[model samples]
Target: MMQPDTLTVFYDGGCPLCRREIATYRALKPQGVRWINVADARPAAGGGTGSACPLDRAALLARFHVQRPDGRMVSGARAFILLWHRVPRFRWLGRVAGTPPLPALLEGGYRLFLRLRPWIVRRAVRDKRAAPPG
Candidate 1:
């Protein structure tokens, strides 16, 4: 469980794109945001590297997620909103995006991104393991 002031973010560390984005957020060093990479084996679900509300590994890897201080788990575009809400520069954007019907529109776009995420990850990483075996 998170402290009243903290928000826990769950991400896939193995993903190059995810790593880069998380690094960017880490650079900002926003207060009360705890980032966890779910790529670790046997991730804890009660806080720290593990999430307060754990999801299946596959599900965690498939989308972005965040657990609020109250232990509610949110994901995809909504998760991004919670994150942006913490960052000073992006706070307005988060609030605006979170407004009525905007989340729904963003979710539609997020679902489309999910469909192409494999391709995007492959292109971003360009690692041998991510490449097609021949």
Candidate 2:
């Protein structure tokens, strides 16, 4: 509800699942928003708040992050909702995500997602390990 300039989304690019979801988001959405794949979310000088991409990759991979036009940063479900709202079709999903119960639901879902993420990461790592040296 604050300013509407640029939006920065912090996601773990190493995770194929996360990348897939981001790809879907990018596919449907236009150029209105800027997606930032950060390795970390910790505040940095002109980082996060700034409209930069591929910054602080280490922090972003740790968790989900979103920086609003108000220069405020939110993580987890809140961040997801912010990006969802930007999509024309998913506006309602974003609104629902903001609701008290929905945020809770989203948190629960995120927990489950986390449970599965490690398996995904391990498998991905294993695949890379198995690949012949090139």
Candidate 3:
């Protein structure tokens, strides 16, 4: 069971970009945070320290999601802000981004990025495949 103050992060492990970014965060060893890979068939079933996700697997996989210690679900840019605040070196960025206007602007950018993500991932995969092995 998770502590009352623990935060849960749900992410799409199937996406290469998501995997790489989550790996970076995991490397940081952020405190009081739990990472869940929604891409797995049984992600919410005995996968972490908490109960099953309140949202369905598809919904969880579709966007960034974070479960606050208060049991509130936050998504998109706001979710990112919450996550950043918990990360050691990213607290300042989170605070700034959470400031008025910035959150709205960031959400807009995130939406655009989501729309372009499929194309971006395809191109990245192609490029990686074309690159010569070292």
Candidate 4:
């Protein structure tokens, strides 16, 4: 069960970029935040005992999602904004980006990124495979 103050983040762990970003956030140890990896068969926090994700697996995996403390589920750039506000290092960026026009512009950019993500991920994988062992 999630507390009313808990913010839940739904992320796709299968994507390398997403995984790396999520790992960075986890390292930050934000307060009152729960990270759920939608790519897992049974996703949850603390060894699969957290509350179930609000959306179905497909919907959760489609884009970035953040369930605010108030229980509002936000996606895309708006979702990123909500997440940024929770992290001390990103709060300023969130405030600036959440401003009018910026949010819209950021959303457009996010949409484009989504469209190119598959190719980007494939290229990243290919590059990793071709890199010689350190």
RMSD of each: 4.8, 5.3, 2.9, 3.8
Per-residue lDDT tens digits of candidate 3, residues 1-134? Answer: 77888889999999999999989888888899988888764644544323456787777877999999988999999999999988888889999999999999999999999999999999999999999998
**TM-scores, in order shown?**
0.82, 0.70, 0.91, 0.88
lDDT of candidate 4 at residue 120, scale 0 to 100: 99
Q: Per-residue alpha-carbon lDDT of model 4 for 45-114, expressed as tens digits?
A: 5433245546777777889999888777899999988888888688898899999999999999999999
What's the TM for model 4? 0.88
Which ranking of candidates, highest TM-score first? 3, 4, 1, 2
Score candidate 3 by lDDT: 0.87
Which segments of model 3 are wrong by more than 4 Å?
A: 41-51
Q: Pick out the ten consecutive residues of candidate 3 with the lowest summed lDDT.
A: 43-52
| Lowest lDDT 10-residue stretch of candidate 1 | 43-52
Point to the candidate with the largest lDDT. Answer: 3
In model 2, the runs with Cα more than 4 Å from the true position are: 1-4, 39-58, 123-134
How many steric clashes does model 1 contain? 0
Q: Candidate 1 residues 15-44, lDDT tens each?
A: 887888888888888789987788884755
> What's the TM for model 3?
0.91
State the TM-score for model 2. Answer: 0.70
- The lDDT ranking, best first, is 3, 4, 1, 2
